[model samples]
Target chain A: MAQVILKRIASGDKSAVQDCLKTYGGLIWSLARRMSPNPEEAEDAVQEIFIDIWKNAARFDETQASETTFVAMIARRRLIDRLRKINRQPNVDSLEDVLVEPTNDREQDLQVCVEAREAAAAMKNLRPEQRQILHLSIIQGFSHQEIADALKMPLGTVKTHARRGLIQVREFLGLGSDFEKEATV
Target chain B: MKDLQDNRLVELLADQSFFGLSAEEGMELGQLKKRFPEWENDFSLELTAAAIGLANLDVREDLPANLRAQVYANADEFFSEGATDQEVFNFAPSANKTIVSPPGASVAETTSGFSFWQNLGWAFAAVAGIALAVNIWTTRFEKPSEVVKNPETIQMPKPELTTAQKRDELLASAKDAVQISLTNPKNEKEIVGDMVWSNEKQRGYARFRGLPANDAAKETYQVWIVDETQDSKTPISGGVFDVDGSGEIIVPINAQLAVKKPKAVAITKEKVGGVVVSKQENVVAIAKV
Candidate 1:
């Protein structure tokens, strides 16, 4: 098994610090810049996110997720918290512009984890509106209201689409075991 | 695990992972979380979001070289095993400034910032110690300074010091100052910040990074200093403040009553203009001194 950088970090391995930074730094930096309103905020968010990562290094469970996924989870939570705190949505492309573009034709340079690839495939299986709503909410960071206004759908409808679409996606990603296990019990 | 079993919880969790939740929804989710203790973490859906976000990230930009260097330096200090309590709190003695410890305080009391990490569910509390002298000094020293025309003094452009800079200055000037990190005691783990208090100066400041901005008309954050000299049930009101923007915010602590010995500092969400005394509910963060 590959040594988890976070576990190494938890053990006070100074060398894992560099490895962790090198591995997830770009991913976090990109997420921050995309989610933040400005470059300076992005930089600050990056620092705070790194601090959170370091603090949470001991909590990383390899049985639950890959290191990249765990790091991404932390980064996303931090970014969302930041957005909620700042009362700002991600400075992403307009809904119209993004809707016109092919969502799958993203930059290939960034590494995609297995879950994300499966998520992408699952997204394709969603209804058009559901896919679009999920895309707007997850990728573009649009609030339900914002998505409703953009898509000219009712707010409740947008939320339903988002929730239902997400449930489907989660199930497709093999994350529906919670429900399955509970049902059997 | 029970989240998926309950449709409402699933909906809330899904909303949380996607574009986030409304204040009402968040409260509901938090309430629901109490019913399901096995819900160890809320980042499961966020993990899915991460995968999608990673798959679709427009560009993979490299971490700035300067940021990389800063991270390494901080990590070195943070992970250093031999660092003292002061160093852990980032309060090294300045070259020109003399170090003076706060009276009747020990190293253990001042260095409780790291305890937040070790102990989960530890409620954050604010500063303490109600000094009667602070009240007398304020009342007796109400004199306006007469402007003396000094042409010899160079009127340099004085750059406004940031809240962070002011915090550093307070730490440097007040040798007896205490700094503590604050965190949320609830399901939301993103809220984290620090409080710096100086009993001698009777002045303090709270700095927060992830505290949500509030609508001034609807709600505001009120700070409270739990003075050991006073009743544990009733803390000294540290005035009300608002977070207007993102990133680090520094709010000066405005203690209504003189604080002599603060055992903990707390911030609670109150109605507009704040209340005379908080019901000890809706507390956002607290730093146990």
Candidate 2:
């Protein structure tokens, strides 16, 4: 019901920058801290990410994705690029280390909150191994080899679980079949 | 109508939305979209599903107030310079320190009230000053021999070549190596690559030109060494790697087990690390030996 912060920033309102920081600074900082290897690097990355966000503000399409999702997408792109540049290897952590069962207390858009809740609920239905693979892939940003090393599972088994887990999650969200028809509009 | 091909397409879409689509898969996806527009919807849904999955991970911690102030100041400075917002990205922390300005100033009324000649002279002076400063800084702080002797002092190390470089080196030195083309059956010419291996050396390299850079977090392309002489049907694991960029990637063959009589080398899209045995459902390219 309110004008999106990105739209205001795109219109060259300097005050919107403050408003955006108040709203999403924590979200971006948390993500940067998680992705960056060190605090200084994280601080620098956060600065660059805000600059990127400013430049890309005009391109945000709320119809396609929520504001938080859009911001997350941009943040990940920058953070991942930094990660690749440094060739920093992440420690392989077992699935138990990463997966946090979603709680309903957080404040977010209703639709977004619903989707997150659905994904969390669906995760409960998955086999422990499948859930582990999904968590590593989705949350921790580990490659399959890292997962194999961390879990001591066969590489083939990891792929099987990843493929099956994603498919099952999609189904559980009621998006497996007839998903195309719902998405295009 | 929706069979194995549909399932494969769905898997490819999933990979594309979560990580990235390989160039070969991208081509296949493009064709599928053109032929079957409904596939676009499927792709969109998959992307949404990935975003939703990510939403569960959102746990926020407030940014330090100083960092927020820094961001606000940077943005204000960037906007106040009368330069377009996008130009702010051109300011690198290291290297040239020129503040970029908008082009096309009237010759008669240059800002700062400096005439053309004065501005030109000042620019030359600035360049000379910068050069002298750099020389002094480098000589005083970083002696070349000392830096070489004690590399740890450098805050940021130079980027090393990725695994692709190692693969390229292996291919370059391989003896008696044969080159074979990897082709897809559906779109044979569109998605193709070359694999060079030396049977005697028991080593090889795969050079794929069109594979998209994969998101290391989601999926990776796995190489398989098809050895028929081993008395087993399972292809030897040739290690796992992800494409970092679009264009030819030369990856060294890392065979888990020894390769006896070589039949062929195949590549399949697998989960990030790779799989022990491939189901072969998403074989992007195959180079027969």
lDDT of each: 0.63, 0.59
Candidate 1, true inter-chain contacts retained: 0.39
Show where candidate 1 strays beyond 4 Å: A1-3, A89-98, A106-109, A180-185, B1-5, B22-24, B80-82, B85-289
* Tens-digit lDDT track of model 2 for B1-289: 4455566666666555444554688898887677766665443344344454455444334665445544553465445444545332213211122211113311112113433543443355355543342332223234578667866433231222354664555467666667788787466675577887776555577878878778888887888887764423356667667888887777766564435568877788887556544667888777667
DockQ winner among the candidates?
A: 1
True-vs-predicted CA distance for residue B3, candidate 2, Å:
7.3
Q: Return the lDDT, model 2, position A54.
A: 87
**lDDT, residue A185, candidate 1:** 10
